[model samples]
Target chain A: MTETSISLQDIVLHFPKQRNIFGIISDFFRKKIRRFTALSGVNLHIKQGEVVGIIGRNGSGKSTLLRVISGIYPPDEGMVHAAGDISLLAGLGTGFSPHQTGRENALLYGSILGHSEEEMLSKLDEIIEFSELGSFIDEPLRTYSAGMKARLGLAVASAIKPNILLIDEVLGVGDPNFREKSKNKILAMVKGASTVVIVSHSFGLMTDVCDRVVLLDRGKIIAEGDPQTSIKAYYDLEE
Target chain B: MGQNGPTTPVLRQIGVKSNPLLAPINTLKEVRSNRFLVRNLIRRDVRGRYRNAALGYAWTVIEPALLASVYWFLFIMLSGNPDEMYAVWVLLGVIVWGSFSKSLNAATNSLTGNVRTMHLVFFPRSIFPVSGVGANIVVTMMSCLIILPLLYIYELPITIHLVWIPIGVLLAGFMALGFGMMMAPLNCVQRDVQHLIRFITRAGFFVSPVMWTAEMAMERGAWGEAALWNPMVLPITMVRHALEGKSVELPDSIVISSLVVSFLIYVVGTMIFSKYERGAVKYL
Candidate 1:
């Protein structure tokens, strides 16, 4: 029996071009909307426990594909099938409020991720320790540096053991030491049975972590194979 | 884990279910699953409102108290003591209206306000309006505490009928939630809906029985009879009747119609909300 953790068949996603408030008001009378296709007729499948790295240039639909797979954006066409609870580490500090302390933000983020308060509280010490914020954990998030915020975000997100994890550009932030620490933490997470899909621009990081690499360009998969071959093809495409 | 090992079920179903009939059931299931998320959102909303204030949660009570006083002065001066306990009546009406207005206002902006988090997380979208209702309910309960002292001071008789006050508040909440669920998604699509609801709610304050009693409307005959059609009329009147221990005659037809309308609004609102909820993030 083949175990497929994630599958997408002919997936298509189109985002209606956003309009300014005034434009929206005028369009209310005009009733016209323009759409931009983010992904079109893309298909992929990942086996259980496979680490797939998605690499693409900016506006190449890398993050959009991750979102579609995570069930954030419903595909305009096609089907997405996945087995297991999925966690998305999209942008840093998506759930954190500037006015809230790091401790409060952790609990809030945990709650948003479907963990109960008691459950989060029980894991509070571990999350704080992993974030390495120390006394700053009690301070409001507005005062934290970008690196500090990224560390906290990654720590809280990885603390929960998801069945499938979708990561997007989160590993590229923070200092070298913390980046290495975060990279190891992610490696440890994927070392388990969890299927992972990471989107990044850094070829070194992608080759370091991914067992397989899928290259996307303008909403289409341009290449797929072992990390070295795909990374080579991606660099070749740049020329 | 092996190829056939049991794993956690899929985190989300990719497409929106096509069956309209099942939308409400799916929404209910989503709510039940995200109950903890809803609770924390309510806490965050209520706490976040007064986070940096010196007075803190005291502002919750102070707001209604201040509103009640203003209404008390204006109405008492205008009518010159139509009823001996008119002050209590106005206070009750104001508090009940407070809950409805607060819920409606909060739920209207709930989705638009949380577009950032909505884009990041994949929980049921209904959590926003539900949490909005939850937050306002907390504020209403806190304000209701003032009634205890007022009850003692006024020497208002506590009959079994007073039990209906909570039921009345709950009904008001349902009405607000229904209206809110209807408007929240629409507001996401159009900024106009937000301004429109604000206007309606402001006008609604005068149109509802917040400042005057049903008896005053009845004194005007046809206008009084027509005011019975407003959804807020029954709940406000019921609360006043419950608190004052007055034997106010509520027509059976009006009571039944009000309840039916509230239920319809709730059912229809949920259906409309479920339809638009999935697409809300797109517009946002």
Candidate 2:
């Protein structure tokens, strides 16, 4: 068996209840503000090269779990151990400035992912080719459509091959042709001994690509099994 | 933390560090390790800011130049007799004060400005504020270039005392970084904190030693001594003194205490930011 790539033990996280200024002031005089739990007592283990899918309704902590595993959010009560470099793909085109050219924004985004400019330059041809942006890469990002921007974001993000890739709802980007191409790239990564964790509402893709699926509800894991079983459980829960 | 290889298991705990006393030291280490990210961010900020502007980077020099000239004119008109060095003095003060206030306000807004990026990836959240200070410092140094021409126009000589200028700039930068780090987290939670900071920095201009020197303040006796405790006084005064090629005239006790206080504030600010930053992100 492959070694465990990600190990979480009883993770718990809470977001402070947001309040207006008046509510906060009144609470200061009367009581402490309350908190809403995002994740509570979540434990999961994934071995190397596994493709794990997380499915849940909105507000069900699907995205929160990915963040916890990637070390974005510090769990309030648990220990998280993961092997190798982790890259999170959430909200593509984040940090992209519309004023910069696609090439410039690509360089900036690469740096955000810990790659140097030289490294990004080396991968520039592949990024532009994969993004299908062609000569348009020289133009300022303000000229790109939303789809073009997301394509550029995905191309740059995928340029660096990470040990663990956590994708959050970004796979459903671009035209169907590009989506298929990106999916193939991810499958190639898994074949190359990388772990993949994806959070998405697209069940058909989840069932087709995932090795295992986990269903979450109200911040707790409710079911875990092969893709078909867990997805069925999710559908039943919704009903 | 990043890993070396796939085989090396990286154990990352998802909560604040257990020891608060070592938090600042650890935060410094984290920031140091991510220096590349900081550098790239600084470049982006510097380049993006000027890319669309008509004057481009020239605005960096023109802004302080215009503000300094207006103040210099007002002072000359008010005092009746013109001090030959007063133009250079006001120029230096305006440049340093511009950097200090921008650093403070930028630091406060740093995290909020980068909230989208902050969530997509994790490095050191402190990098946002650190890079904010850095970008402002780069612009301020560029702004200082305008002062060189004024020195020649005013017919002043460069002296060894001018070495104190960078020191003063850095001291002001460090103090602003500390206060801004503390305010960044608070500003993330309650946006009112930002408006309050804006007001304070605006009021700060009149209270700080920008228009007047510490020598003038010391002449007022105890009130001046107490005013010297404002933390901004020493650095602003240091720059103004260096430009005038005069030795700093503040009491040794006050100087030492203010220096120590700035350092302490930095330490406290780092600790507070590390502790509360995660919580603050939720608010954003």
Candidate 3:
């Protein structure tokens, strides 16, 4: 009954078959190079303020679908219409440079996410606080561990609340304590009425947060229902 | 954060379109909206280059000056002209041609160089190349300052024609951006494209009017006409004309033709870039 916040109609995305220089040169004279279809004829609609979970095996178009909705990967066919600001929390620390300090990379990452530098500056303290990096924020990003880098990325991206937030398998990052903190943060965001989409292999978080779940297998949505039903469907696919 | 009161959802529509004419206008709009990102990127590029070097920013000025001296020495050895004016002339040529060549090469590598950011977030993919052009323009204008000391040393009188220096620099940028927009996408599609760009720019340094004035080439008759085939001839010559404070002896036909070619390249480049950019990611 609620207004649809994001709509996808028969979306399809494909990537050219990888080729070496010799292969490409040969293909130039020969015929067409093959393409690997990542997503094919997928259709779905998400309502405003609803939490949706997408679960799929590796290379089943889970991340690719998220990219499509975020406008990173333009669909080869069909259309994507989203009614609000959308931010995808994949590849955390998007524009980060190892040579730059943690604080500087935070600003750069935030700017890449469409926030102005001044706005990021204002939130720099909050980001540092949430990241718990202490004085290490001034140290170059190369000094940080994988978990530290993930923490810094999450801290900056979550600083600005988006109307629609899509998080990808990033909740498993950082220490167990930080992982719990991030889960609480996402739950808070959902409670705040932000339309949220999550893609994760784990269904425990989905059972706790998602109103409905969509199961994807080899590019198509195979089932959609309550979280319990979709989880059963996913397990059946695995078997 | 979702108060749900008086909310106007921002609509984003994504689909495929075949129109090329609209590419430029769309790019302009994207650039305007992301002006801050462009500015930040340009600043980062300029500052990042000198971050850890002991010489730091001095390298910006010293680099062209050093190249100028080498070329000046070589010209004297080859032509046996000990004229002080020759030193000044070589410096101006080196500065202009260096920036133009670097701009082209930089823009070509721009997209390939920023694959992480390009894939992680969606701004205009065009921003990378455009900022590459911007950073080069900034560096060229700054590097042009070396000309001041050269002029003072040679006691060359500054004239009204000196105004053409900035115009020439900007025109060089425009031309480079056109070529860059066309090449950046392809460079992503094929890694070899970047290597090819490097080779072309290197070879271009000799064939272009960098070492010799268009006037010198013009006196050679057929060689002059052949040299005119390079679009850089006019801008390079224009910068030299500004420094020497001489009338532009270039014929009207060549000037008009160069301008038209530059504009057409820019339009066509954007068209190709916009159409192929989304697909280029597949290769990346």
Backbone clashes, each candidate? 0, 0, 0
Residue pairs in collision within model 3? none
Candidate 3: CAPRI quality band: medium
User: What is each candidate's DockQ, to 2 decimals?
Assistant: 0.47, 0.52, 0.50
Order of quality (TM-score): 2, 3, 1
CA lDDT of A31 in candidate 2?
77
lDDT of 2 at B215: 69
**What's the residue-level lDDT of A103 in candidate 1?**
93
Docking class of 2: medium
Q: Give the poorly placed runs of model 3, Cα more than 4 Å off.
A: A18-33, A135-145, B1-4, B8-12, B16-18, B158-161, B245-249
lDDT string for model 2 (A1-239, tens) is 47788888999888877555676677688777677899989999998778999999999998888888877788889888887778888888788877788988888788787776567888899999989998899999999998899899888888777778888987767788887887786566545547889898888888888999999999999999999999999989989
Candidate 3 local distance difference test against the native: 0.83
Deviation (Å) of B21 in candidate 1: 2.3
Q: Rank candidates, DockQ, best first.
A: 2, 3, 1
Candidate 2 wrongly placed segments (more than 4 Å): A18-33, A116-122, B1-18, B246-249
In candidate 1, stretches whose alpha carbon ends up further than 4 angstroms from where it belongs are A18-33, A97-101, A135-148, A172-176, B1-13, B246-249
Q: Which candidate is the best by TM-score?
A: 2
